[model samples]
Target: MLFIKTFTRSICTGKYSFAAEKSLLAALRKKTGYTFANCKKALEMHDNDLNRAELWLKSQAQALGWSKATKLEGRHTAQGLIGVAVNQYSGVMVEVNCETDFVARNKEFQSMVEDATKCCLRYIESQQKPQENVAKFSLDTEQLKGLHSENDGKSLADKLALMIGTVGENATLKQGLGLKTCEGIHLVGYAHPAGHVENGLQLGKLGGLLAYRSLGEGNDHIEIAKGICQHIVGMRPTKIGNNDDKPAPNKDEETCLIHQEYLLDDSVTVKELLEQNQLEIVDFKRLECGEIVSSIGKQPLEFVETCQ
Candidate 1:
């Protein structure tokens, strides 16, 4: 048996290549590797080994496939970053970003992101409904085809690609979602006031809705619900609280205290709302794409440890 190798350079990404065959001076097969340097050395040592050269190429391709998979989902890894958040109730919220504010604010691009978020939410919600076999629910790829239209005629991802093509920078969804629970919990959702992805990234610009038990309640429930909205926007608590952790506030003027403040009045906390109306806050959620102000079982204003 003899060893033979050949070397070449790719026009794209400036990577290296190698070729090998049985003959010292005959046509040979090609092999590619991570770097041109490695290919050159391998070619020199194995000048006539076609089988070994092909194996090396396959090994390199497998190694690159792992990195490609992460990007395929448009997730931002530590090196390549993107931001997304999701919870039990509201579904997945993704933040698709570009380099400049000009591109970030692009109407076409923003529409695609919004539509995609809706698709993801709709997909997850559909998955959790009462079913005999829970495993049947998976994202219908066909829905993704519509994304190219960006709610027009293109698919959402295609629209994103158009944005990338127009903007001259890499643009992809940085976030995704999988909810932990959906029952016994209602989710209030917020989009940034601007209806823009970056707006979700900013503070005090979020718009959210409360998904409470659509069952019987009183006018106080409405008022309390409004208060919760305010709390979501103002205090931005991470989770609803039990009574033992902190004393309910005396007055409602404070916007942060959920238990002591009435929805209609900043002066009263949620406690006041409950006492007056005979109600309780089962739980609540606040949606902020970037900075988390508080977490469940925590203080007035604290940052969330992780979006995950």
Candidate 2:
């Protein structure tokens, strides 16, 4: 497992408190059945295994009633090293990862993953409404720092070292996805058994999440939500309108949730069917690769300089 000495040093220097470290060590040893002394020694020997060790620690914590198990795996082989996982607590799900598979499965590594996720879920819940009504949301700095507060005991790469040492592999948590619920409106979600799988242009990149206020029966909600989920995952739509003039790239396409043609049925837009059925759409969220895009509208620094 390849670990970044500098990154690990910084995390341990500020975040790893004695209490947290002790808890993590206990959980790691318990889960992997490795002696605490041996686990600590392994971490001391490697720098890249910090995040991996953290995840193993998280897994152990879950076993001890500290958290719940979610999907954890090693990824990004072409790059350096990375791992990813989903953890559930209360009603929240947090995606976590490390750089290597070896560390990801270790007890100490899993503990860190669980702890970090808990901190993130708690922070998000306290600050933001569960409803996705807000247009913008981000993590707070204080809470971010709090998650790393237990980092003081090990070398810069102690966590990563522990991960690598335990798993004998390199890794780190790269990114995550989260959702919450609130009154009035309900949120519906589903994911591929594993994380995401890369495919050509359509089915492979889509995941579904739908949120709307329902005045109908419980079974109705499930049926409707299932239909919508299928539509989203199965159909790939650039825009949801009949008019080519109103392509998804246009501004107007965003305003009418119903009018957007159903990805599953090009014959009618979501708007058209809702009106026909006398249904109302409070809001909806659809995530697709090459669809809901991130507009980082900027040229490279070199390009700007040359043009100037």
The TM-score leader among the candidates is: 1
| Regions of candidate 1 where Cα sits further than 4 Å from its true position | 1-92, 130-158, 177-187, 194-211, 214-227, 248-264, 274-279, 292-308
TM-score of 2: 0.43
Question: Scored by CA lDDT, what does every candidate get?
Answer: 0.43, 0.41
User: What lDDT is reached at residue 91 by model 1?
Assistant: 37
Q: How well is each residue in 177-245 modelled by candidate 2, as lDDT tens digits? A: 334444555545434322331221011123454544555545455456546655654553343333444
Give model 2's clash tally.
62
- Using lDDT as the measure, the top candidate is 1
- Give the TM-score comparing model 1 with the true structure, all chains together: 0.46
Candidate 2: RMSD to truth: 16.5
lDDT of 1 by residue, 53-119 (tens): 5556444544444344334444331211222233444434344444545555565555545666665
